[model samples]
Target: MEQTIQKRLPVGGDSWVTVDVYGEPDTPGLVVVPGVMSDAHTWRHVAGSVDAWPSVVVVNRRGRAPSGALTNSYSLRTEIEDLGVVLDEFDSARTLFGWSYGGLITLLAANERPIPQVIAYEPVMRPFGRHALPDLKVAEGTADWDRCVEIVNRQISGFSAAHVDGLRADPHSWATLRRLSGPLYAELSALNAEPPPDLMAQQAEQADLIIGQRNRGTAPYGTSFDHVRQHVVHAEVHELPGQGHLAHIQAPAELGHLLNNLAAI
Candidate 1:
């Protein structure tokens, strides 16, 4: 399986963003956005499988692996700008796909652009009350990296072992889990410092919502989606039974098929 990988230098920085392009260059474009602390590599398996799409660009969001500068402040506006920089470089009309935090970025980006289509696999709209974190301990008062890692590890391990095993089996999914464990916790702490209620509402208005019925970790757990569904005129919901947060990994074939159908429409 051959893949074309490129280090794209998006304007506004020297930090060259990592981009993985699959299939032909001139084909209809699909941009894959990874969740927090994830890299372009997270979409490797799915990109390889979706050969029908003309082009798929997987992005390594700023401050993640294979990218530069791990900053302490993780602002939603800055993250959305980073994505805008990437979008400016591409010539083709594109469809945006986001998972978890990436979904938040995707929704924000759509607000600033004329995105013809958008697909999100359970975006973390927690600020809108769609997700809850009862046990989530926000790390503060310490900039210690090791402490951050320890806190994140403990939280991850607390989840069901069977669920973790299912994630580990998928290369694309587990790679993200391993790389993002620490940074995700740190970012979560930063986000907790200042909840983005206004931004969350803005994102919901912009996105064509796609809700996973069993995605209890994010959308299913909160009232954010309910608010989003009410406002977004083009919002469409799909319920996948026996699937959780990582539906793209757990049900890749089903997701891929659905995406293919979406592209056709």
Candidate 2:
């Protein structure tokens, strides 16, 4: 097994963030912000495959395990500040990679501070149709992880019944997804509650938006891709053949290759 370097930084008096450091530390590398239900532990495989940078700094954002809990005051700003902390401290993290919700944060963070290079994969930039958060919240409140997982997979993720069943059949995957559901409720609720962020002020010099070919034309994700192409200057969209939203997990090497190419520019 490859080694992972871990660092925990206190964000505020109450909140904390942990980062998994992979690759060489001799130089600044790409900083990765993960999705709604993932942190360093879950992102390990994908982070490992990305060798285009000197290091891979994956942020374990709030609401996820190994990081602080979602405080009553947690909001989008909290997520940005946590990411900003990593960016401010890590001078090597001049480029950023964001997945799903993390992609949204990457764009938002670029707005606050100009990033030299930014890449986002299927960011839920605009709140899509109903996530049934009320139901998901109730399930979470009662510790009904299974129900919570089902709702998120079917509703938030747009997974088919068969897909959900397959996930449930895999004990290991299901267990991780269930654990992640605890934080999913709060994060999705925050995404749904906030009005669409102002993309006009985003300041990335180079930006790339990636969408899975299988995920194209999907309601929420489709519009999100369009939104980025429409709003972000120099934003280019790339579709991965034979893939879906989970490409980072399903095809990390391929995704890493694509990112490396994007960075080569």
Q: Candidate 2 residues 5-108, lDDT tens each? A: 88888886488898888876546788989987676776777777777777888888877778888788877778888888888778767698898888888888
Question: Which segments of model 1 are wrong by more than 4 Å?
Answer: 11-14, 128-158, 161-178, 189-207, 216-224
> Which regions of candidate 2 deviate over 4 angstroms?
1-4
* lDDT for 34 (candidate 1): 80
Q: What TM-score goes with each of the models?
A: 0.74, 0.93
Q: Model 2 misses residue 51 by how many Å? A: 2.0
lDDT of 1 by residue, 1-265 (tens): 2377675655344454667777665566888888754567656776766654678888877666566654544466667777787777665736888876787678767766777677776665545321222333333234444333344434432445565566567886555555565455544544444444443324332344555666433433334556444544556666656665555655766666667766776
Candidate 1 root-mean-square deviation in Å: 4.8
Clashes of 1: 5
Candidate 2: give its CA RMSD in angstroms: 1.9
**Which is the leading candidate under lDDT?**
2
